[model samples]
Target: MSLHELRLLPWTTPEGNPCYLSADSDHSALSRLADDLEAAQLDSGAQVLAGARAVLADPGAGERAVRFALTRAVESLDDALRVAVSRGRRIPARHR
Candidate 1:
């Protein structure tokens, strides 16, 4: 689901990790689904938002979509960190 459809309150933790609170704990499956979504290769903020919106709108949707969204989020964050490190030449100098 797009962030808008999911009504996600986007905020970062002290460590700069994006996180959200899900009140719909009745379905334990949603938790894992969220994790899977965070692991996907959603390389752009816009795509993540769009995908999240689509998932959140379908109340009857399977947990897979949630998983996909979570995957994307995580992948995006990982990409960001890699970029930051690369820009600073933090990796072994020889690797560059």
Candidate 2:
């Protein structure tokens, strides 16, 4: 497979660069780990959304609480977007 076909992992390196997997298929141990991590990231993002919504609906939420919720929501959104882009790129061109 070409470099274009490399699987974008669910995480980055220590320097915060994107990571990729070069296995022939997505069944390798490392690929499986990546899959698991992606699932966890998505799940965490959903939880963060719920919390953020609750915070937004709370009229008494202080600035600190709103800021904290906003920060977490931004982070979860970034993760979710990364996951989307990675999965989208992995799709076959013909399927597009």
Number of the top lDDT candidate: 2
* lDDT minimum window of 10 residues, candidate 1: 1-10
Q: Name the regions of candidate 1 deviating beyond 4 angstroms.
A: 1-45, 88-96
lDDT of 1 at 29: 70
Number of colliding residue pairs in model 2: 0
lDDT of 2 at 72: 98
Q: Quote the lDDT for 96 in model 1.
A: 65
lDDT per residue (tens digit) for residues 1-96 in model 2: 344478888899999999988878667899889889889999999999999999999999999999999999999998998899888988778898
Error of 1 at 19 (Å): 28
lDDT of each: 0.54, 0.88
